[model samples]
Target chain A: MKSTLDSKNLPILLPVLAFSLVLMIWELMVRVGCWSTDVFPEPLRVIISMGELISDGTLFKHVISSLFRVTIGFYLAIALGIPLGMLLGRREIVKHLFNPVIQFLRPISPLAWIPLSMLWFGIGDKPAVFLIFLSSFFPLVVSTTAAVISINPVFFQVAANFNFNRLEVITKIIIPAILPSIFTALRISLGIAWLVVVAAEMIAVKSGLGYLILDSRNALRMDYVIDGMIVIGAIGLFIDFFMKRLGRIDSVFWASATR
Target chain B: MGHIVIENLRKEYSNRRHFSRSPGSNPAEYREIIRVLDDINLEFEDGEMVSILGPSGCGKSTLLRIIAGFDKATSGSIRIDQKEVKGPSPNHIFVFQHSALLPWMTVRQNVGLGLRNIEDKARMEEKIKEYIEMVELGGFEHHYPYQLSGGMQRRAELARAIAANPDVLFMDEPFTGLDFLTHMRSREETVNVHEYIGKTILFVTHDIDDALIMGDRIVVLGGKPSRVKMERTLHFPRPRDFEKYPELGKLRSEVFLMLGVPYAV
Candidate 1:
């Protein structure tokens, strides 16, 4: 009973202690250095500002808006990327045709597309969501393609011997075989989407956590800026946790279980 | 109806060797064509269990794949039930040396894969259970391939193949990696399944003992460019006790001799 309790509590306890230590150090530094609230707000002041933002419903609005963009953009990337990746993975000619273009587009930062995005999609949520989509899409495609390509060829040979049609081969053999890798890609691309949405929002939109940070900075409210940053970090952690849970689903348990 | 006929079957793999040379050096040598199977002609009677025995790299697997319609022969034809073998069909199933059970699927799902086209769901479920029980994997229906032991994985794969209800089953060294006891048990189970279902089976293996134990007809293939070195029909009765029968010992020695391996009685 003691060992189980220790094991269960250790993970949550360690991180909590580390975070408290950091907050204590930050509070000490602010007091010792006598830094102005404009430059470096106290950790307690940031917490109070967070509570105020939460109470006023502004935090909910910003978080919900950002989440909405990520959900639509990331899922859109998935919808387009997985099938394209499957096609490119299976067909050498198609891969050869599109590979150079994909590689060229892959390394460019999604932020670099902001000017063009603003021009194409204009301001507000459209441009920000488009940027998030662009951020997630390339990684999803690359990872999905690699996943499909790396599947055991024996599986395909087995499918052939079983006389699986094209659809059956894809649905039964290809998709399931590549699902674990695809989930890895999903997690990675979701993180990228989350990161890019902040930058996208900072420039192209006016109502997300990124915008809140900018708005608070312009108004000389460092505590509110820190509050926004904390919210973003917390939400990012939640998203990653959700994805890790998704990777543990029963169908793809074989791949992750061994890991 | 599942009798297989192969005539003049040949497979050649061309290896193109790339040579890096200085400006004044000689040009690269021409590509070498290695013949894996040469002029292989064979026949399998309906419901017959035939073992194609060969040493490593002697084209035994190539021959099996060709017969199973997974690989193309350079110069001949294979016919099943008087129809030309064009490509892979649902009527025949090939079990590889490695278990081909999809790692993502459970044992039940893997077996159910073969029964996808069967419209009657109840029959499909019943067949899946029956085959799973046949391979003695009744309790492991929900276990994935990676979760099972090597022997169990092999049994699950056998169940998967048998559940397909194929007209012919081509097994390429299916029990090569199991422990001695597991191998013996699996071989017994294979023979039992063969007797029960009576599906035409082509078992490929490098082990002379495996061939002698399981096959009704043993085809020994060997040499650099492999061909049928010898073919012998075993008329021994069912459940032939190899340990007790002197005739079985003689047959074992004969097969070993054909394989060019020295043996002692």
Candidate 2:
């Protein structure tokens, strides 16, 4: 399969070429009878604006602010969600008791909670972080619960045959068995958390990428607004990449093929 | 001493979806009880290997599960070594038909699971390697279950189960999905392990030849709500060639007829 020009390079080349085509089209739209650069910036103007933001270092500050919120909120959700999900998944009675309430709350949209969160935590990082937490918590719990329930029953039998106590059953059988699903759940929740952090920042705080975009629009610096959007998209891609790499850890490698 | 006595074991299951399907219908009409096993009584001598043969869904696996304490029998009792079976214990291990190795762990780690109680780390490692080698999985110790073939996975599971030092082993269709050569090879491997360990084992299989060739005693189950249709001690010795031994041939056809197969071919 290794010829003179490596066949493995084709997959990498294809995506790059496709993205370049998209950028050319974007530039063409601006060059032809499109709106002025201030109204809707071109790709080059966005890049120039990005360079200016980088030189001023405000971009880094905003990015870090957004990341900090995501980190705290995401960790909080994980710490609480996994244990509760496992408990609910293992015992049907507990699931039945609380699952309805959870289901009803899950679909309410974290955006709708903005007013309540602002009122409860007041406008600052606290409310923004709270909104991010709410965005991630429900999906994490739901996915973890489903993952635990979907585990192969034979592993439990194997656990029983070994005379596993409660702790051993959880650590040895349940945890390891549901690992792949847990990674998937983490990926999805992280995505939701990242998405909510932006919207939350726009409303409750003035130190994040979302605030940068809103502030730029008020000043009519449309180029800076476009730069903020570009940074958000780039960071979102990076988060997904990081999660995919995390899932490829040695423990979950066995599931990579099957999944 | 792993003698097991299963006395009049019976199992019944009501449809789990009955209530949801017809909520207001008569309870008796909606609740359909499926009888899986009925009045199964069997006794195994210490260190004997018993192969249980039956038609598909004849409750053969159900009976084995009950004996292993993975499932509750609707009624009856199972006594192992004079103690009544309550729930699954380390004294008995059941090898599933499908590969049940923990997907996240390597073969070495999987084998080490059964030896978790061993405090001496060196001894545990030694035992793990010994079992892995026993099943000819030594080179694949770091490989996961998905990385191995069907035969390798089964052997790995066998190593894991045997390393636990269970007194009674239950196998449900251990070679159902293997290719022809692997099936023959695994059956040989099972027979060898049985002779070496001399632990009482109860195995369920749909293959008649496996029972004839590998078991010290054979029990055939038939019909819905299955009952033991035939039980016999195979006195004809191992490596029993059908062409060479008239009695083996006679018994093979006899079993075929009993199982409702006309030609015996």
lDDT of 1 by residue, B177-255 (tens): 8999999899898999999999999999988788887899999998889989889898888777777778988888877
* TM-score for each model: 0.96, 0.94
lDDT of each: 0.89, 0.90
Candidate No. with top DockQ? 2
lDDT of 2 by residue, A1-259 (tens): 4663476888887878899999998888888955987897888888888899999999999999999999999999999999989998999999999999999999999999999999999978999888888999999889889999998888888888888899999998888878888999999899989899889989978899999999998999999998888899999999999999998888877777656
DockQ for each model: 0.75, 0.76
Supply the TM-score of chain A against the true chain A for every candidate structure.
Answer: 0.96, 0.95
Worst 10 residues of 1 chain B by lDDT: B20-29
Worst 10 residues of 2 chain A by lDDT: A1-10
Each prediction's RMSD over C-alphas, in Å, is 2.0, 2.6
Candidate 2 pairs with clashing backbones: none
Residue B162 miss distance in model 2 (angstroms) = 0.8
lDDT of 2 at B64: 90
